[model samples]
Target: MTGPRWIAAAWGQSSLRIWAMAGRKVLTEGASDQGVSRLGPRDFEPALLTLANDMLPLDEVTRVLICGQAGARKGWVEVPHAMVPCAPHAAPPVPAPSRDPRISVGILPGLGQTDPPDVMRGEETRIAGFLLDRASFDGVLCMPGLHGKWVRLRHGIVQGFRTMMTGEIYGLIARQSVLRPMMDDSWDEAAFRHAVDESTRHPETIVSSIFGIRASALLNTPAPGLARARLSGLMVGCDIGAMRTWWHNRPVAVLGTERVSTLYASALAAQGADVQALAGDRLTLAGLIAAHERTGHLEPSAAAHG
Candidate 1:
């Protein structure tokens, strides 16, 4: 209360941060070196304290609400209690306040099992919040990333989802595998479309076709750029093929970067399905804020740090 008071909020793979007020103005800032792996409570406290030391005098700050991956960590002394269970059919409308008021922290649980016990450190909750109020659809929501997710949401609840190692696999093959020599770092729309065409037509060939990048250069079948595009296509195409049954007659919404979304849109269009693309960052942020609001931990006046 004497010097400055602050609140901190963080999401995703980004670094740890702090938010404070200077004079009549609010200041939000963070440090890159102070980042943590995930919000496991055990791993977060040290990081949080380190971040606090770097950005602000720890004693000056009053209240802190730790959420997201860092907040999910297992062991931290700052937050000492858990919310009690409500009645089976009479769950509380909002999250209850922590009995101790020194520091307020809530660790949201990840959706476990259902699909190989997949744990989304932060994205899952954010995506769930983003889908609130959307009409019910019996289709697939594909989130393309290093570890891609194909989620099926029915009646506003995640019915089931599948994770594919598409992006990571592509990066490995493109950067370290034998295919690296034959790939061009340049972009060619024609090559991309051709790859998409091949992938859509023969999805199952992706596994073997992945190595075809090297073969194509040696055999003089495709240019370096074309080979790169074909590799991408094969990976995406294989995923699409595996997911085809899920999207057969249903509308599809793709949430991710423009390139991947565009490719997915092209592939989906070929299958005669309705496709819509949403901004991945926007959705992720919205979902996160929504989760915070729903849990009553976030308020309209709450300012995000970093």
Candidate 2:
């Protein structure tokens, strides 16, 4: 695709973000064709290089703010690991480029301290921006994905979070595990609820329960829909069970696609908790725009147009 006249780029493992601004107005904003599962260092090079290349010819373009996971190490920003939960906020240092000049880059750090740290990459920075002045809730914020995050937020900062390999596990089991042979590709809500109920009741048996789909099919269980529901139940149930302590009595705000958020809502509601799902797109955009505003990259004229 041809580059836009002006652009703000944010890169991640799953997608490349571009916000193209013209004059004071954002003409368009969207992601690249590539998805995170297919992302690697090589894929990111072309994506960023292409944006930089495109920016060279657009004299109207004045600023480029790049942040996210893709900007770390092999790309733009670097930082030493820290052990504190809420480290002092620091802006990403200006990168010394290899050759590209059309794009100016900034990198943001992740949350936490450890090897397997909870890094925000691009979206975290944006989320930070969106969270400005939002009152802190002693609750959980669910960000769903291939690597879904169940975060504990206290007083407007992230205290701790656990990553659930729900999406990846679902993909693996649905395609390669024995469950694939007995399950249909379509969704069955009733069956899904049934599975949810069952998993909730017997949360400890999640692993074996996941494999039960194959056994049920082999044993001549009447409904393919039930089998599918069972699969869904196992994952959601296990997640709920694992997070029971973390989420107990806390309001849950899910941040992601409605479907995933709904599943989380259902699981939470079943346990008698107040839960809500926020629009993923809006939150992401708000977060990014907020970051720009915080850094003074977004001037009054830009704010008026935006």
Candidate 3:
């Protein structure tokens, strides 16, 4: 029971989540709003210690394995991206200089593609975790978030991937564009599906079609909910249209929280693609654990020495 305890961190854009662990068993967990976006290089260590310092032992160093934006050029320490056609965790974890000797931090690298020119940080970890138990899986993983990623995998290697700004575009239009007036928290399932069909079938009309939402408001008083749903569908559908090769008549896994994944699943389903939705947290943990194991920094023997 006295074995050395380690830390696992998923430092994202807007939040920092960590688990104090002994091997695969978590002893404690903590979270913070000090996401990578909100901190400077100097602030990364302080932000981590604020949440994990209490979990550290008095005389020995505790190893910390981190994934996500903390490795971005602007984050704690910029780790290089592992070129794709490679393993999900292909890039090694890079160490960050720490002011405190009690803790050692390593940020895992993200994945990058050359031909189409794409990159990802945290999602790579989730992909690794998902594949850990299903090494034979050969398909696409559609991860929806601020920036949605459609990744191609075969024989446990990340063949290539693409990124879409669907979520970010939605946020921008909802908050800043002329479409702002029709945006709200409500949704219309029928309207959403109709919009998806329209976009998927005729993607070229997307640019012109977006203006119709505002025009509809000026002419006929459609509910704000309908307009919002229609907008989301149009955006998501456009993304799907671009990545047809990845999902058309192929097995696809949609990885994300229920809310986000449901929207993507609905869109993919309408296109006649075989899709399965999965929750992402456990997979993220698995990926981080796998990264930790690969480092050998917290192995039973290593921990005992610490």
Q: What is the descending TM-score order?
A: 3, 2, 1
Which regions in candidate 2 have their CA more than 4 angstroms from the true location? 1-6, 22-25, 35-45, 49-57, 72-84, 87-98, 115-123, 296-306
Per TM-score, the best of the predicted structures is: 3
lDDT for position 23 in model 1? 25
Q: How badly does each model clash, as a count of residue pairs? A: 7, 6, 0
Across 1-306, the per-residue lDDT of candidate 1 in tens digits comes to 322244444434546544443322346555454444444544555565555544444333234444344533442322222211211011112221333333344444444333355544444544554566474555678888777887776656566667888998899988888877777886666666667667767787777777766766787765546767778877877888778878878878888888888888877777677888877755544443444444442432233221
Model 2 has a clash total of 6
TM-score of 3: 0.95
Over 1-306, each residue of candidate 3 has an lDDT whose tens digit, in order, gives 644578999999999999998878889999999998889889999999999989998888788889999999999888999998999998778888888978888899999889989999999999999998889898899998889899999979999999988889888987899998788888899999999988988877888889999998899977858988998889888888878877887799999989989999989988998999998988999998888777755444345654
- Evaluated against the true structure, the overall lDDT of model 3 is 0.88
| Span of 10 residues, lowest total lDDT, candidate 2 | 296-305
Q: Estimate each model's TM-score.
A: 0.71, 0.81, 0.95
The alpha-carbon lDDT assigned to residue 89 of candidate 2 equals 33
How many clashing pairs does model 3 include? 0
Better of 1 and 3 by TM-score: 3
Can you write out model 2's per-residue Cα lDDT over 46-144, one digit (the tens) per residue?
Answer: 666654554344333234556556556554445432233552234442442433444444444554535455555544553464365454666787777
Query: Over 4 Å off in model 3, which ranges?
Result: 1-4, 297-306
Single out the weakest 10-residue window by summed lDDT for candidate 1. 83-92
